[model samples]
Target: MHISAREREIINLLLDHPDGINVQEIAESLNVSSRTVQRELKGVESIASAHSLFLKKVLGVGMYIEGTPEQKNELQIAILKSGQEFTQKERQELILCSLLKEPESIKLSSLANDLHVTVATVSNDLNKVEEWLKDFDLNLIRKKGYGIALLGSERKKRKALGHLIAQQLNEYEFLSVVEDEYESKTRFSNGLLEIIKLEKLTMIGKMIRDIEQQLPYSLADSAFMTFTIHLSLAIERIIQGEVIQIDQEVLEELSISKEFIIASQIVIELEEVFQVNIPIAEKGYITMHLLGARQRQEKNDWQKESSTEMVVGSKKLINYVSKELEINFEEDQALFEGLITHIEPAIYRIQKKLDANNPLAGQIQEDYPAMFKIIQEGLSEAFPKIVFPTEEIAYLVLHFGSSQVIYDNSKEVRALVLCSSGIGSSKMLASRIKKEIKEITEIEVSSLANLRNIQIDQYDIILSTVEMPGFSKKYITVNPLLPKKEAEQIRDEIKRNSLTTEATLLRKLHNKKFKKQIKLKTPKLIKQNLEVIQQYTETVLHILNTFETISLPFIPTSSILLLEVCKQANVRGLIGDYFEVTNQLTEREKKGGLGIPGTSIALYHCRSEYVMQPVFLSFLLHEPMVVKAMDHSSIKINTLLLLLAPVDMQTGQLEVLSTISSTIIDDEESTRIFTSNNYTDIYSKLSYALYDNLQKRFKD
Candidate 1:
């Protein structure tokens, strides 16, 4: 009962065309097999009979509903009374039966493969088909390895076919209309041969005789013959439940019809039947044949227009022309505008020249050498040109080039800044003004005392900390001594000059920041950052350890001593020295009036490794130390110690200091381990935690 989407599509296509579709055609349309179409139809038959619907088959034409006209009428009335309640698949199957003139038996294997199902399923469908036809003394006749056929009395078959036809007419009125149109068109044609090809040879002879009587002069011309062949092929495909693609243009041209209404109608019908929209142009020239109004081919004449008249000026016009010619153009504003203005008139003039009757007009190289050169240059610059009428050329040029002219409506002003001395103060003021007030019209800063020496007409607003003589009162004045509030006031004035300028700039800035943030978060960017940091640190470490001994800065008198402790044991020489300095610094720093004791200081040489790798160390003070000089009371003596090492170090003693800093600054457990003298244990614990944190944060 539940049909797949593919089965539904196939059923719809079949239902679209009445009079019976061939099994092979159905297979082809559904991209399966004739056998598959048969099996699916059988399944449909079962479902229908289960619901008291009749399915019947014709001897040669195809299958239909088996019932008398009155019975068919009754079925139709019942279906209407029931409001046509059916699933999409059921509806599709009904439609197919209505469209098809004949339904044929096909092999179960072929059907199974086409439907992508097991042969057992096909057998089950056959059983249902037999059950559906039981009331009419009809049943599915299976031949070994051949296929299954409907076996029933001719009267029963006719009645069933009538029932199907009536039902189809009720559901889709368009099917009858389409068939009528097709019959009208092919009534006198020999194309019926194509439709009868799949039938038995004995039937073909009878069909030929019937065709001859009906269409005596249909084969008189090759066009009619071709139409017959194609139409018959199409009918055969439809009967077989296959979707067919007929060349719309070819059909129209072959028929010698100027209008393609018939072809369009066919497309619409097919679309409705199959529920698939085919990609095709709505309008196009059919080149298969030349007939009537289409017989006259326009000649491409070059000497009909003036050169200048052909020029295109406007970007919009250029774009229109380019689109017509399927060409690409640059989308930049300035370049496009310039191209439109400068080239439009020239093209128009050229068009005019080309349109002249004189033969010389077409010879651009001889008659208008300069114009020809310009065209060549434009072509090289990727501009497109088409051989169109002079008027069209002129229009295109004007359209593409009209936007090039720049309009100036705002007043222009140049202002100068005056200060006592043109040094730090004046420079600072200029920088501040530039940064804050972007719209000052024009700006000039100078300490030159004589304002009358320069052109006074250019000056608008004079800003000076000192007094200036001979200044016009009409000009605005502001102090040169820059203050945040004064800068803000000037900014406000600039904002008033242009309402949207600041907002636009801010939007642009925000957009840029957003783009940068996106780039920063990319995996590639993070990897690159890590690589650069590692490289820089390694290089600095190499330099500091291998070369350069440097003296430390003299400790200032105001320096707060941090540590003072007796050296307990002899450590590694450099390490011992570092410890002594750190201990003393920690004691001295704690001695200040501020109450805190756990603080410690660490020192290292300046080197790449030390600088690149941050230093973190942790230790708990034995007794609480106080530094009264400091202010905050939240500071506690029992705390973690951290030290930042320089990029260059004289002694290699700072190596361990690097890892210590990295640890204590990040996780809490590092401080615990450092206080416990369990460096290795602390490293293990922190490393595991770090790995877990990174995995959780960075998993894809």
Candidate 2:
């Protein structure tokens, strides 16, 4: 009988470890809970017995496979070829995954018949699948008479394929790390699971830990996952005797590098575990990846050994980059200082055939196309002798990108509004600040009389209507009414003070979080870290299910858009019209426009007394409607979602509600709100995934 992928891995691990390995050791290496290792132990023995072996376990000593080397190798070979069969959900995911990962286009009818579903159902499923494609800057295009194919960048395609494989082995962070309430996880594959196997993934995970120990830094989670997948693929090829060959010169160069040394160390462990001979040139492969993986800067320690040559390089790079982009960075001292610190270590790694690895290079290219393209072309000219890896190049792009932003608004900006004249003026000023500034998260108004009692240190900026000439603090003086010109003046003043910018704030926050300048509120600096929290929660409030979506005649104006969704939700008994949800949504629109920047989707959400329970309401226009965005740019909005929750709910509870809706409308999530031709498919794909993710996140 073919064993499950996970059980196969446990068996292989036991076989490799003749001296025996403990449950905890196995769990740590695999990045799984010890409880999972224990559960799999029961099945390992039964499978081992079939091959004339015993998976013997001692209470304190650990577990081992008792058999001759010949029997062990025979069992290992059988397990290598064996793999778990796909479930119905997995088959559907596999169909979609193959279309994206494979080079050739696939027929819709073929996929439907293979998955034992009708063509119509498969067609509907493609809608939800297409949503995932959008996130990678890819399009899942279907030719009328031909077949469907995923079109995008090669790197993005690989990343998507990596994610698909990760999902299959139940290695997904949401499914594995989180204690989700769901009975089963939906999985995907690209016809490689039987070849790659879960055992390889566990070994890959161990390999990553080993590499990390030798480095001065750590890779981002996405970067780490990408590396894990790369290593797994390498091992799979090794098993098939498809070893990679590196040029003699390149191999010699990489052999002396620290990254290659680490890679060599990893190979020793891998060779022992898998009992396969890894090619000598495989070290170069790992070395190249080490250079390609993105690095998150943990400190300014590079500043300590500040070398003059590095400073010169940073200056030349900054100058050429500024000229190429037609921007001013000559006088940005901190930018100079940061670049110098970045370059010293970067060059040290690059010279040794390794460069900093950045997993979000694709995102940087997508979001800042011009910047990335310009930097890519001009970097060689900027630093004549340097051969920068793609990851290092992207890192440089980030430095220049941050330098050009209007101002740094990274922290939760707090503004104390003071009016010497009256309380009303201060309140009015605070309201105008809220309307004008998206960056300022908190506003506190106080009269000059009570200003002494209010802690000035707590505030990032002090905005006063009446200037106190003798005031010892830096404050921006604004008109009481806070007109557009006056608001612009305040913004310019804030920009002039570069320390108050988002870049500066983020750097400070990152240091604090990393060094534990503040207490650790999380199990690790992941999921709950500032970057991660925002990353996951950015598209939280969106449409949830097909029932939540209502088709509308082409919306003409913002006023009508608000009325229709509230009315639709109210009619369905999902909400009641105190028009409080409507009023808040309209208020949001008036602040700017209803349209989300950079997309045709408009999101309107609020917590209101009018809300009975949490409800997600979506409206899609029959034809696109032009609406205003925050920047006053006209956006053709095709989709809109209204998320309403009870006013008294906790922020975490609100996040759960947002995440549920997001699973539907979010372009990244599996369950889509707008794509399915038949609405009922949304209920099945969404109802469980949405609830399950929420439960898992909450438990963690």
Candidate 3:
């Protein structure tokens, strides 16, 4: 007969009150919700029945165990021998939570009395708790006669509390609790929810979701959870008269950030909702969290100065890792973009001393020890002043590991990776599927916040690493590692749903239930399919018809070269105004290097109002000219590809233009043909590529 800590607490409480005890009293005694107490009572009744005792309850009254003294004594003995039913780690966490919640010193004897343990055991646990505090720059104080107290600034204390709460739940559980999707009755989760005030949490989560639209980029799930908790704790502590302090100087520095404006708006709303005046320092702290938060997608308005630094640092890191592993990664455009996106916010967190808190760092270390070591070395060499924690390094390894996964476009199926998984975990899972699952040729990652906006039918299958409580679309849940059994299950799923199988097609055609419907819809379906094909064909023909290679006079500088290309575009009736298009391209080029590294080409691209439509043109330089490459290194380029699209371009048109850009560098044969300066070969190659893409779309 195993008794949980809560159940044992209930029995002890009932024994003390032999007259009667109600659910409210038991809940208050255990510091849990009344609902939680009611749920735990089911197991308590079973325990009582096993002990030869009956729990009696009367309407509008109370309940108690009706049994002999010997039987009650037997139940007490079982509880005593059960030893409180808490592991060492659980006990330690509970003790830490107690210390964090208290403002003054707490005696060892008092802690032991509450946990049903001895003072000596608590004293030992305090040693480990003290070590954990040091990570947050906090200290534990103890004296001979006085009790123990945590010593730290209020800001550090709040940070420690938020981090402790986050550690108690994984990403899915945290989001579920915040969204009120379901109720989980675990001890830690329920306790933390109670402490934070669950109603307030739900309100704060909603407020943040409403405000997310004003943000430039989407917040990752982990970051969203962390920020929500931080705000909730801030409000709770503010009402309790325990306010944190930040230096005016530091606050002033933070006030210059774009996040500071958004934070101010949030604080204004908080003041209205809670009817309390939040301090200015609270807004500053909020800005700091926003600055240190991770984003799922890239923002176009990212600061140019910081982006330049990230570009330089990322290229160095990639070069170092590639050299150490003897693998060429410089040409991997996806890897380059991914590293920049991840490293930008990561450096912010590192500078702010915020922990990455990755859940899979240990597993990643075990799975790819060599790759981990090389990236660690690369980080140290690339950014000497910053120390990369194992957690951050593990995430970087996932990015590199994903870049190594070869995606075969010949495979037909597409999968969408939905969250409460973070970007790192999602990419690792996507990489696993690409490696083990032969049918999935493409994978798209999206967060739960953006799930409603996604075109659900575009993907052949949806894969998630978390439980979706009310999701309408059917999605398969798998572990991030995608073990062998899950791989086989995915294969079976794809096979069963496959439309290409002859037997399945025959069955669908011959089934009596569908014959009438198919006969009636065949004409309409044919018309719709024809319209779709025509739309795609029009885009393809427009791009190929406008694709031309021209020889340019000597242009010494990139600025002049861009002007010359725009002039040629004007002459070819591609743009309404050549000067406006030139300015747009030059402004974009100023943001970063447009040249593709290790190649004799520079990709100049822009979206402008002056452009008539999507256009792609190859310009051959009279002489090789020096240009800054994507890696910020000086390189000589003889060919420049200008890709332009209107601001209001359609999706299919933009995709067609993108296909043309990809064809230039997607393979060696395409790259050679584009750089060969042979107009006949270049035109034929692009026409065939576009035609093939259109044919594939029709087939699908």
**Against the true structure, whose lDDT is highest?**
3
**TM-score of each model, paired residue for residue:** 0.19, 0.37, 0.48
Instruction: List the candidate 3 regions with Cα displacement exceeding 4 Å.
Output: 1-84, 185-191, 294-306, 355-357, 406-700
Q: Show the colliding residue pairs in model 3.
A: none
Model 1: per-residue lDDT, tens digit, 391-438?
223322333323222111112334466543232223334544664566
Q: Quick one: best TM-score, which candidate? A: 3
Angstrom error of the Cα, residue 688, model 2: value is 62
Candidate 1 similarity to native, TM-score: 0.19
Relative to the unseen true structure, what is the Cα RMSD of model 1? 31.4
- Residues 617-650 of candidate 2: C-alpha lDDT, one tens digit per residue: 5577787778765345678877775656665554
Clashing pairs in 2: 291-355, 292-357, 293-357, 293-358, 294-357, 294-358, 408-501, 408-502, 409-502, 410-502
- The sequence of per-residue lDDT tens digits that candidate 3 reaches over residues 409-452 is 11357688864312223444665677689777777776565677
How far out, in Å, is residue 175 in model 1? 84
